[model samples]
Structures are given as C-alpha cells and as structure tokens.
Target: MARKLPSRTTSDDTKSARTRERILDSTAAVLSRKGYSETRLTDVAEEAELQSPAIYYYFKSREELIEEVMWAGIAHMREHVEGVLAALPPETSAMDRILAAAEAHLRFSLSVSSYTTAAIRNSGQMPERIRERHEAERAKYGRVWRKLFKDAADDGELRDGVDLLTVRMLVIGSLNWAAEWWTPRTSKIDNVVEQARQLISNGIAK
Candidate 1:
C-alpha cells in the first residue's frame, strides 16, 4: 500500500477547534472575574490574546459566548465529579464515595477550572433564556449529589431520621460557597478539602 499524508483540511480543523476552546476558556475566566453583566467580547478577545473579531468566528455574539461558558461551567464540573465517583472500586462504601465526590466538587469549584467558579458565582444572574437552556446541566449535577445521598441512606451510613434533602442542601451549598472565598493565601487547598470532607462525613455519619 502507498503511504498517505494528513489532509490540509484536517490541520485547519484542529487549529479551529483549539481556537474555539481558547475562546470558551477565556470567556469562563472573564465570567469568573467580571460576571455576566460586565463581560464583553473585547474582554474575552484580550484574555485569549486574539483579535476582537476572531471571537465572532467561534461565537456569534456576547450572549452566545456567555451561554457556552455557562454551559461549560456546570457541564464540566458534573462530568468531572461523576467521573471521579465512577472510578471508585465497586465495593467502595457509599459514604466514601460521597466524601470523594465532595472533595472533587470543592477542588473543581475552588481551583480546577474557572468554569465551575464562574458557574457558582453567577448561578442566578444568567438571562432567563440562557438559564432555561443550561438548567438541565445544573439539574444533572444536582441529581449526582442526590443519588449519592440516597445511596448513603440506603447503606445505613446516614444518621437515623436524617433528611437527605436538607443535608444535601447543606453539603452542596457549602461546597459551592467555597468558590467565592477560597484562596491559596487564605488556606492550602488540601486543608480546605480535608475540612470539607470532615464536615460532610460528620454531618452524615451514623
């Protein structure tokens, strides 16, 4: 057989994909800092180090870019945290899985990706249309936590009479809140993760 070479079109497509990802990443970081109301295409262009017009090549408008960023925020975190949980051994205890998930959520929100931080920071400020569009993603993440809680209850890890919904609210709400104030200067990320793990474990320990 004759040797074949890569197509020029394939190379161009790869570059285009990278550029699109760069735009989304820049938008996420900008959303974390400036928020939805203040983010501009020019701001993202500067952050991505691309010409202002280059952004439109990937996203049609500010609203479109923000929508993608918002979607990426929750979607990535949910995927990542679920992936973490899924990797545990089949015999792993439900409470251990839950603690791993809590750590994963805290780390992702605080340091892993600006995307999740942006999501946590602007949960309620997204336009109604965008919120409606991404609502499924937020709900999917909610379901992950919900299932973990349900598993704990089924496995007898949760304290008797504990309300899964209320404890779920406390745990998820506290983990999300860490995105707002956690910093390397304030505490080691590991320390924060450890403390959060303890809180979740203690709150639900039977």
Candidate 2:
C-alpha cells in the first residue's frame, strides 16, 4: 500500500507556507495514485481544500507544480541516503555503506513519502522543460550513488572493469521499481529491503 504524507507545519511557519505545503503534498499524492496525465489543478484543489484559482497563486501551472514536487522528492532522498552514510563510523567498509544506503533507499521508496514515489512514477513523461529540470535533480541524486559505487571501487569491493554509472543505474533502477508493485499486504518493507540489500551485495560481486 502507499504511504500517507506526514504534516510539515512548523510553529513559526506562516499559514501561507503551510497551505503551499498542503498543495504540494496533495499534488504528490495525486501524481503517485493517479498518473500525471490524469492529474489536474482541480483535483489538487479538491485534495488541498482550496479553490482552483488558489493554486495559481502558489504555482504558475500544473507542470511547474509537479516539477517542484519532483525536485523536492529527489532532494529528500539524496539527503536521507547521505545522512545515513555520514552517520556511520569512519571505518565502516564501503560495501557496508552501500548496504546501508540500499536499506534507506528501499524504505524511502516503499514507506516514506508519496513525493518520491510520484517522482519515480512520472519520470521521463513530463513536459520538455520539466523533464530537463527534473533530470538535473536526478543527476544530483545519481551523484550520491555514484560516490557510493566509486568508494566501493576504491576499496576493491566493487567488481573490476564495471562502469560506475552502469552500476549506479542498475542499483537505483532496481530499487526505484519497488514503488511500482509494492503492497503492504504482500511483504513488509523490511523484508523487501533485506532482499534488496542481499541482491546488491551479491550483484556487486557479479
């Protein structure tokens, strides 16, 4: 099953900021549950409990709003994986870091927020401008994994002669797929993550 988004309000935040967040959050939910082609300003308005015109005050167009949510999603995932790696001990093996990141990525994809799921779901199908900008954000997220793969290579843990970019793509591509078919009733997120970690650990050896 899909995960519900958590509130992001703050004590000092303006009501406007909170409402904007609600709009973005609702849009992400719609984009994840419904495809981008099926989502509309009115659907978001109804979900956010606001007038359709109100959305214009926050975002210029549907593409612009969707772009923001997608960007936010990649940013969230990058920060999460980076934080998990940074918190590890200095002597933690590169392979261990990769496994830790695999767990983090799986959990984020399966159980964290709809923003990332929507980002994954709608990737490559956005407007040209939106796709370009989102691809830049994607490149940034890709760099995080590239570093993980590179570090493993430096440690002599990654398979020799394999391209880091290819490894990054395979790892991220496979993990991102969990968003498509995962349901809570079928398997727990932890089980899915564990299987992914083992696959990565072995696949890196292949």
Candidate 3:
C-alpha cells in the first residue's frame, strides 16, 4: 500500500503562509540595514524572535531567506503599481494617469521605506528568480509611461521634437531617486508630489 499523504487545508495553508511572511518581514529588516554580505541566519532569527533552527523550517539557508525577502519586497512594489493602475478611472487621460501613478509610487515607496531600501541595496545579492521578478514588475510599470507619452504625442501635448523615451527616463529617474533622500518630516509627501508634478508638467526642454 502507498504511504498516506498529509492533507492540506485552508487553515493549514494560511498558517504556513503567515509564518513565512513573518520570516520574510524580519529578514527584510535585517538585510536592509546590514545587507546580504553582513547578514546572518542568526540575525534574522533574532529579529523574527525565533530560534535559529526555526528558520531552516522555511528556508534552507541565509541566501534563500534573503531571496524570499527581496521577492516579497518587489512583489509589494508591483502590487502597489497594479493597485494604482486598477484605481484609475477608465476615461482619465494618460497624462492624468501618469501623474497619479507618480504620486502613488512616491507614497508607496516612502510608506514602505525599509522594504524599498532593502530591495534597492540588496538587489545585487538576490537570486535569479528575484531579479527576474523585479524586471517583470518594472516592465509592467514602464507601460504606464509609454502609454502616457503616446497619448500626449497624439494630443500634441509635448513640445516639438521632444523624445518620449527621454521624458520617461527623466521623470521616472527623478521619482525613483527621491526615495534615497526624501524625509517625511522635512520633505513632506504633498510637497514632493507637487514638485514632481511641476517638474514633469513643465517639460524637459532647454
């Protein structure tokens, strides 16, 4: 007779998922501050308030644990972008969508500061799967800029001879880099939003 298999249920799966999430969250905190090279399983375990051996139950090694954390962070960023895309009104112009998307990106990045910081700093040490996931999310988000530029061009909103790709690079590069230095108390989000809107709307022409 074949050996009996363990039964999987909604409750069991949910519990397991929660535990995995707890480990990942703790791992992100450790990796974000100390980075992959300096981080250790003990650090993650301590941060999570779990025994070092407990970590092995979810991940085989520190590398795997870090990979999961990076994966979760990127997944979160993608979800934020997708949520913004979904919330947009169907009749809204692409330019409006772009502005809204920028605000959303800024809010999410700032709100999840530690996770974003960890993702950016430890991205190089992440596994191939994490890298691929990050690229996919980026490509999906890039479509928003492309669509906005195409619509703007169609509506004659852009200045003569303005390159759409250049505009995207300038705008997104600025927004992403803001996470590096923006302070919640001093550089408030509303101010950042307005400044970004002004920068993009003012056009990049010399």
| Per-candidate local distance difference test | 0.89, 0.87, 0.75
Quote model 2's TM-score. 0.90
TM-scores for candidates 1 onward, in order: 0.95, 0.90, 0.79
Writing each residue's lDDT as its tens digit, candidate 1 over 1-206 gives: 98899899999999999999998899899999998889888899999999999887877788888888788889999999999998999999999999999898888888889988988898789878778657889999899999998998998998988998998998888988888888889999999999988887787787
The C-alpha stretches of model 1 lying farther than 4 A from their native spots are: 1-5
Best by lDDT: 1
Candidate 3 C-alpha lDDT tens digits along 1-206: 99977777877999888888788888878887788789988898898888999888888877667765666665677678778878888987666767777787778777764676677667667656547766665576678668867887787667788888987888877887776677777777889989887777777422
lDDT tens readout by residue for model 2, 150-181: 88898899776878887788888999999999
The reply for model 3, stretches above 4 Å from the true place, is 1-12, 124-130, 204-206
How does candidate 3 score on lDDT? 0.75
Query: In candidate 2, how many clashes are counted?
Result: 2
Task: Give model 1 RMSD, 1 decimal.
Answer: 1.4
What does each candidate score in C-alpha RMSD?
A: 1.4, 7.9, 4.7
